[model samples]
Target: KCAQPRRWKAFDGKITEMDTQNSLRGKELLEIYRSINTRGIPKDERTSVLLTLKWTVKEHECKLTQEIVALIDREIDLMSREVKECNLEGLRKRICTLFLQYIKIPEFNPQVAGLIKVPQDPLKLYKNVYFCHSCEKYLAPTEFPIPANSHTIGRCRSCYQLDNEARQREAYFKYRLILENLRKSEVDYQDDSKIVFLVQLPDMQYLIENIWNCQSALSACSDLYDLVMVRWDKQHEWSPWNTILLTKEEADAHLKLCNLQKTYEAPFIYRIEQKHIRAKNYFAQIPVMSSFLHRSSNQSNAN
Candidate 1:
């Protein structure tokens, strides 16, 4: 009775590989295997780590039989004593592959259910396919380039690219750079950043092409690399409603700009307001960004 109590206490505490459990499930045994077998570990140190892991499994009560544990122990003991340059990486990986199946089972790990891409009912996958208007056929969801804020799904990515190539072909490389800079700036500001993730590539393209017209609002410069997107009002966090395109020179000047109404003429201010309204309407479709709009509106009301 005293021996059983000591054995249970040994397992109850941190069980090192050298510790022995009465039994172990396949998963626990695999964990023991992973916990040990440290490659590149010094030979003198390796024995201690291996011993701790073996003992840990031996003390735990699980599905593995005593014979299996004895066999594994014998192997480990031989390897430790022989000091042979035997590679165990492949064997360890094989064991991991076999044991991972237990962890991946839905019943065992319900938390991972959402991360599994495969549909529970594979035969019903066809139901998820959408009809692309441009392609004029049903295509899988992967083919579509739907933005997070898009109200309706449209053409697949391939169809959209082909259409752009034939018609309004414009390089979005500069737009991509501007978007990246915007994200970095937001991160530095350390405000809520989820709204940035909500904006997608297609949405950026639309804003550049239609809203800002892909040129400096003041100078109307078209040099892609020279142009940047900046906050309309310097005080506010950048958003679709609160952005303007400017040349690098203009952007620097605008940052130093103290008073918009004083520096810019009424007409200039009005046009900028119009652009803001358009952007506000466009970005409002994104569900997440709408929260920002409401918050901005309340802030404006407070002021």
Candidate 2:
């Protein structure tokens, strides 16, 4: 009988040789690996890859690292829906490597285990140490104030606060409260993927003070606590351009507003649109806001 060909080949002197690593199929797989984190791919393919990854992780039932499993599960759930972004490349590669480590090689299985050892004491390595970019020091995870749904590791909360006070001289306590309330009210909104985290306290202040002129659009109320930001179009995500600042009572009325064309005058509609355009122009400077804008534009185009 003829000898079976090896699935992988040794690295040859030539980069273009038909060795395992140099083969066209191997290059294609590498290209896929590189693109696993890229954003321009179609959503269906992205969804499929994540789903297959989750299934593979489940099938093996690997116990060495629940971290990868947990991350995979989270990404799968997050990417299953049509959202603005999917940036989980680091987690994806970590998952792939761990999965590869478990594959039984003919004679190198023990060598793989040696390289990727199952820890003798797992708890020893899982310390919550995080490096604060602002302070240039490693601190505990408690030093940072990460959002509930965010994978971003940011500067330490102390450093963030210090910078905000010293440089920005901005008050975020009120904005923080507003964000907390908004996130808490997500159940009522039915969609919880708004760009709330990207909107800094300073940005909120700008939108309120400069854009909306520190008063409710309807009642002209100036009390910051009494004023609340709500969606202009209830079906769309609440963004700077898509929001209206109204007093507690006015916000209640606005939320219950069903027919805008009938409820408000033509002049009022024109004024609100003017405010939206102003907000769009103002927030367009922020890079993160572009994704929300893109998402909004795509939705509008689809409709």
Candidate 3:
């Protein structure tokens, strides 16, 4: 396949029609390998193609990299969803926390790194890895966060976040509908009468989603609906998850945890505004929120 250019000239020798097609396909696949941390084609002859792919070309690497990242995200999502039945609550949290503390990956690593064999399936090398939080599947334990208590055990963080977000979203919508009904049922009232949207998820998996979707609920709920609290319900059916609710401090903490906390100051200084963001320790308590109470007043004032 590495026929010299001079040889190609004889038959259009290296640059012949068939050669052109082969080169095109090779270049494209090499580009893909670059992003997923791989190079070359399956056969030994093609392995060095990507490494040889010229990098001096402008924008070529970047375009391929973006596509690669997106592809990785899709794969991770599917992987995180397969283990939803695992109810080992404490272990999940510990593993996630530990991972956060120790999992210092460079954001994304090509799965094909260190791979020397041409397996029957390359995707399998990536599957069941990246133990992120969620109900999906995983290929390796390292993909997951290391447990806080142990060195080897891991769980999928993305799955955990997704499940948390879903539950929070449901509660947000349900509470929002109730508030809208209340507003419609009311006659003109004084400022003292306000509606609140309170939601609590039973685990971390659902809380993140609720927070992510809060903007929709905030806009739809009555203007008087100034307060919203969503947390994991500690009730029997959902006792082992994260909670959501209107805690001045804890709520903001969750937002920060989900990376949704807003910029209040020009300098961008921030805090765990939801009043401690309800650390794992607080999971057992009945988080309370009343319309008259405001925990995030400090943050709002700063903003």
Stretches off by above 4 angstroms in model 3 are 1-136, 150-154, 188-303
Q: How badly does each model clash, as a count of residue pairs?
A: 19, 1, 77
lDDT of 3: 0.36
Q: Which predicted model would earn the best TM-score?
A: 1
* Every model's TM-score: 0.43, 0.42, 0.23
TM-score-best of 2 and 3 = 2
What lDDT does candidate 3 reach at residue 191? 32
Candidates, ranked, lDDT: 1, 2, 3
* C-alpha RMSD for every candidate: 17.3, 24.2, 25.8
lDDT of every model, 2 decimals: 0.67, 0.66, 0.36
**Residue 51 miss distance in model 2 (angstroms):** 98
lDDT tens per residue, model 3, 203-247: 332433333233222223322234334332211111112223332
TM-score of 3: 0.23
TM-score ranking of the models: 1, 2, 3
- Best-fitting candidate, scored by lDDT: 1
Evaluate model 1: give its TM-score.
Answer: 0.43
